[model samples]
Target: MELKPIKTRKIYEEIVERIREFITSGELQPGDRLPSERDMAERLQVSRASVREAFSALEMLGLLEIRTGEGTYIRQVNIESVMSSLTWVLYMEKDAVLELLEVRKILEVQVAALAAQRANPEDLQNIEEALKQMYQDLQKVRLGEHADERFHFAIAQATHNKILIHLMSALSDTMERTLKVSRSKLYEGKDMPERLYKEHALIYEAIRQQEPSEASERMFAHLAGVEASYLV
Candidate 1:
């Protein structure tokens, strides 16, 4: 008896599983061309759109690569090859953005703590320069948005954690959104910039002294203030 058409059988998930099985069964080896849309639709008895969507989803995960003007083909599995797309997904989702910020806050608190314990003359000078930029930008009330990102990234560098850098980069887009929302809501209040300057300075002092715990506390306080201002 002919198998029921995949389209009428059940959910897209069943389709996804069947496709995955086909790949693993060696019927669709890496670099092998997939059937054309018309052919696939006839074989599976599914609409062309569903096939296209499943193909797109697989391609997005870095499992399959689609060449424009060319047919779809199976792709070789490689972890290094997929990092950029995976990282992008981390920022593209709004809820992921909020979760990333929460993760960043926890990491930043620890970063400040570490910087406080290990910062040298150069680290202190670097952080101070960032502070100066924030200060100057605030006095002008223009909010140098690019400088703002640089300022926080500089602090992350001071932490000397390469892993943290990767994680933060994944969430950078989300952070930018929070910054815009916060500014739109509170810039008119005018007190935010000056207060943030003082907070940054206090955190810097703790780091300059190599006092990890104090630095962490100051960072938590600063982020808490930002959260209350924007989220509450």
Candidate 2:
């Protein structure tokens, strides 16, 4: 039988893994300061650049907070953010990207329904504000990716389920990247941005009117359109 070659990791990735182990083993705690880059480099027997690279990645994952004058400290762990960052790296293949969209369709359709039935005034206001932002971006011929993400996140918040909110947070970064790619493809059709905005408007209207089924349907349709654009 033929064997596949072992994959080699970058030095910075190995450093990241080591720091993750430290956190997992309780050697690092929230608010605990990390060693200086020089110290870490000497301890790890690697260059300072690798340690700095690892620290930057950790900061992006919300696992570390780097203050300008105060140095780097462990941030209160946002497990969801960490998971999402890992997931983003692992699922960059075409089939994996489609799988991510499938997961989104499953979770978001139900999330829209729940938001329709349970949304408070504040939740509605947030969703409307995101929708307004989308329109503003469209008027300026921009992608409005942030507003699109905020719109869906606001709907998830409206569900009032802590677990669902956490799950959405975990998926947020990956979804944002997917949307940016899909929107670029869709915008090639000129009217596609307007079409997308109208679809979001319909979903919001259904939720605002407390129509769970309609909200779910609209959300499903919107996601299907995105998937189609991505495939194109």
Clash numbers, per candidate: 1, 0
Q: What are the per-residue Cα lDDT tens digits for candidate 2 across 148-216?
A: 889999999999998788778767766665556665667657688889889999999999999999999
Cα lDDT tens digits for candidate 1, 25-123? 777778988877777767778877777877777777666788888998889866532444446455445565456657768878987887776666777
Name model 1 segments beyond 4 Å from true.
1-87, 95-98, 120-122
* Model 2, runs deviating above 4 Å: 1-9, 25-45, 59-96, 132-146, 166-170, 177-181
Candidate 2 weakest lDDT stretch, 10 residues: 1-10
- Candidate 2 is scored at a TM of 0.68
Please give each candidate's TM-score: 0.66, 0.68
- The RMSD (Cα, Å) of candidate 1 is 5.7
lDDT of 2 at 194: 89
Best by lDDT: 2
Relative to the true structure, candidate 1 reaches a TM of 0.66
